[model samples]
Target: MNKTINDPNSPHSIAAEFGVLGSMLIEEEIAGEVIQLLNKSCFLVPANQVIFEVMTHLYDNNKPLDVIVLQEELRSRGLLDQIGGSEYLFSLVEGVPSAGNVEHYAHVVRDKSILRQLMAAADEIGTLTRSGNMDTEELLDRAEQLIYEVTQKKAVNEPEHIYNLLLNIFADIENSNHSPGLSSGFPDLDNLLSGLKGSTLNILAARPSMGKTSFALNIADNVGVRQSEGVLIFSIEMSKDQLARNMVCARARISPHKLSYGVDEKEYKILTTDASVFAQAPIFIDDTPAISIREIQAKARRFKTKNDIKLIIIDYLQLIEGPKEKKENRQQEISFISRKLKEVARELDIPIIALSQLNRSVDARDDHRPRMSDLRESGALEQDADSILFLYRDEYYNKETTEPGISEVIVAKNRTGPTGSVKLRFIKEYMKFMGISYQKPT
Candidate 1:
C-alpha cells in the first residue's frame, strides 16, 4: 500500500498526497497521460496507439496542442489518480512498490467511481467542444481528427472506406452516368449538374409562375419514387395539401387546372388512386411559411435523424429569416441565411434544393433569362451555393412564340463543373418538368 503523507509541512509528503497536484504530476510522469486516459476510456485503444494517433492527427492538421489542454483532456478521460491522495501518486513517481507493479497499482486504487465520473465529464466536454463555436481552422482540425479516428476504426474491407480512395474516379463515373441518355426525369438538367451530390447546395431561381416550385417538386418526387431516397420539402409559400394536390395531378397526368375546377367521376377515381400510390412515396412536406434558417436546420436535422432524409427542398430562399436582430439590413440577413443553409448542407451530408426568386432586372431584359446576379438580395447565394440553376420558360415572356413547351435550366454557377443551359419539357397543367422531348403534346 502506498504511504499516506499526514505531515502538513513536508513538501515530499505533500507531493505524495493524493490531491490535485499529485494527480496532475502522475499524469505528467506518464508522458502521455491524456492519451493513456483516453485509451482506457470508451475509446478502447492502447495508450501508445492513442498517443500516436492523436499526435499524428495534430501534426497532419498543423495544430499545436498545449500541455494544459492535454492535461485537461486527460482529466476528462478519467485517468487521474483519485485513490490514495498525493502520497500514492508520489509513490508512483518515486518508483515505490504501489506504483511499480500493475497488480499493486490496481489493488491500491480500489475505487474507480472517480474514473467513471471523469470519463463522463470528458465526454461532455468533447461533445460541447465539437458543437460549440470554434474558429473554422480549429473546427477543421477537429473534424480531421474525428475523421482520422473513425477511419482508423473502420473495417479494412468496408466499401465506403475503400471507395473513398478513388473518390475522384467515382465522381467522374457518377457525372458520366448523369448525361442526357434518357428521360429519367430531367435528363438534360442531370447532364448539366451530374445529379445533385450528397452534401451539396443546389439553388434553383426563377420568376413567379415560371415553374420553380413545379420543377423542384418534380425532381423531389423523382428522387423519392425512382431512387427511393427520403426527401423533405419545405413549401414556405404553399400549403401541404396544395403541394400534395399538385404532385398527385403531375403524377396522374391530370391537369392542375382541371383538378382545381371539377373532376368527372372517372377522373376523380383516377386521382384518388394516384394519390394512394403517392402516399407510399418517401416524400415529406412542411408548408411552414416565413421560416428562419435555424428552424430549417433544426427540422432538417430531426428529419435526418428520425427518417434518414437524403434530400431537403426549401421553396424560395428570400423568405428565410436570419437571427433576431433589429438593425440588420435585408441583404445582410439573406447573406447570413444563405451561408447557414450551405453550412447545414455540409453538416447534414445531404443535398439541399432551395428555390429562389430572381430580381425584376431579368424581367426588364429583352432575353428575360435569369442570371447569377439575379439571385435576389443575397450575393452570398452565388458564393455559397455549389450549383445555381435558373428556370426560364419561353412561353412566360412571349405569348405569340410557338415554343410554349420548352423550359431552359441555365446553369449559371457550378462550383465543380461546367456552366451551361439544358433544355427540358415543361408541362404546366401537369405541374411537371421532364427531360427535353420525353413527352409529346396530345
Candidate 2:
C-alpha cells in the first residue's frame, strides 16, 4: 500500500523513488548502478518495491529495460495488476526527465531505508529493555550488534579486475618495507611468518607442560612493552593478576616460585621497576573463564573500536564455549568455535593467536613433540588456521637433556610462507621465551 504525501509520520521519499525508477527506465545502464546502490527494501511503497524487483529480474536476464518488458515481466510474475498495472509503469518513466541523477536519488532512497531500520532497532531495543530478560552484559552486546549491523549495511563487496588487484598488491609490497603487519616480537618467527599478518588466524598448540601460555605472554609483553603496540589477551585459564605476575617475573628474569615465597630486596627493586614499565604498556587482559565465542567477538570488537588493539590472543581454545545448541556434539561445537574465531579475526582485520591444547597422543610418541593432528578436539583448527605452530621443549619430557632451556617452535603449517622450525631460549623459572641468541651482558 502506498501512503499519501500528507502522511508525514513515517520516513519515506516518494519523489526520490520515482526519480530512481524513472531514470532506470530512461537509461538501461542506470539500472545496474541503482541496483547496486539500493535494494528492494529501499523502496517505501509495496508497489515500488515490486516494480524494482521485476526490473532487477529483467535487467539480470539481459532483457531490455522498457515499459513493455517490465510490464511483461510483472505480468508473467502475476504482479502487474496488483501493482496498478501498465499505467503505473508508464508514470514511472514519465515522472523524471533524466537518468544522470539516478545515483543521487538512490542515495536518498538508501538514507530513508537506513532511517526506517534505525527506528525499528530503537523500538526493538525498548522492548528488550522493558522485558529485562537478559543479563546486562549480554543485552548490551546484543544492542551494540544491532546498531553495528545498521552501520555496516552500506558496505558492499563488488567484483574487481585482476589489474586493480595487482595495483593493491604492489602498494602493499612497497608499504611493507617500512610498515609491516604487527610483529610477534620474535625475530625468527616474525621472519618466517611475515610478522603475523592481519586478518589471519594463527594457531599455537602445545602439550600440557610445553609453556604455550608463557610463549604467548612473552609475545604480548614484547609487543606491548618493547614495540609499544596495543594488545588484547583473552586469558581464559589464568587470572589477569596471574598473567601480570608471570609477565613481571619473565621480564625481570626472577623466578615465579621464589616470588611466591617472598621477593628479596634486589628482586623487589627490579619487580617494582618492571611493574612500572608494564603498567604503561598497552596490553589488555580479560580473564573471563569459559568465555563464549559470541562474548569474545563482542568484546574483541569493542576493544578494537576503543583501544585500536592490533593483536588478540586467546589463552587456549578448548575452554571456549560454542553454540549452546551443539552441546551434545563436542567436535561440532569446537568446529563452530574455531570457525567463528577465524571470522572474528577477518572481521576485525587483526591477527588472532589462539593457543590450543595438544592431544594426549603427543605423549605417546618417543619425542613427545606436538603436530597438526594433535590439535585437540577439532580438525577444523587445522583447516581454518592460516598458520599452525607447535611448541616443543626437550627438557619437559627428558630429565638430563642436552637441549635444556631450549624450546622449538615447529611451524607445521604456514599458508603464505615456508614451513619450518624456530628455536627459542626458554627460562622456566621466570616463564619467559626469548630468541635463541638472547644473552645476558657480562
Identify the candidate with maximal lDDT.
Answer: 2
Clashes per prediction?
Answer: 7, 0
> What lDDT tens digits, residue by residue, belong to model 1 across residues 253-356?
88878965798998899989888877778899998888767678767776777688888999878877676661268888888888888877887678898998
Q: lDDT tens string, model 2, 1-442?
A: 1232113566889999999988999898878888878888777788998998788878877899998888888888899999998998999888888888988999998988877767766777778889998767667767877676566564334566687689888999987674366777788888889888789999999988889999999989888998887899999899999998899989989888887689889989999999899877999999998899889989888887778888999988889987777799999998998998998888778999999988888889896877777788758888899999999999988989998889999999999989999999887878888888876444
Candidate 2 Cα lDDT to native: 0.85
Model 2 RMSD in Å is: 7.0
Candidate 2 clash total? 0
The global C-alpha lDDT for each of the candidates, from Candidate 1 onward, is 0.64, 0.85
Worst 10-residue stretch by lDDT in candidate 2? 1-10
lDDT of 1: 0.64
Candidate 2 TM-score over all chains jointly? 0.72
The TM-score values for the models, in the order shown, are 0.65, 0.72
Return the top candidate by TM-score: 2
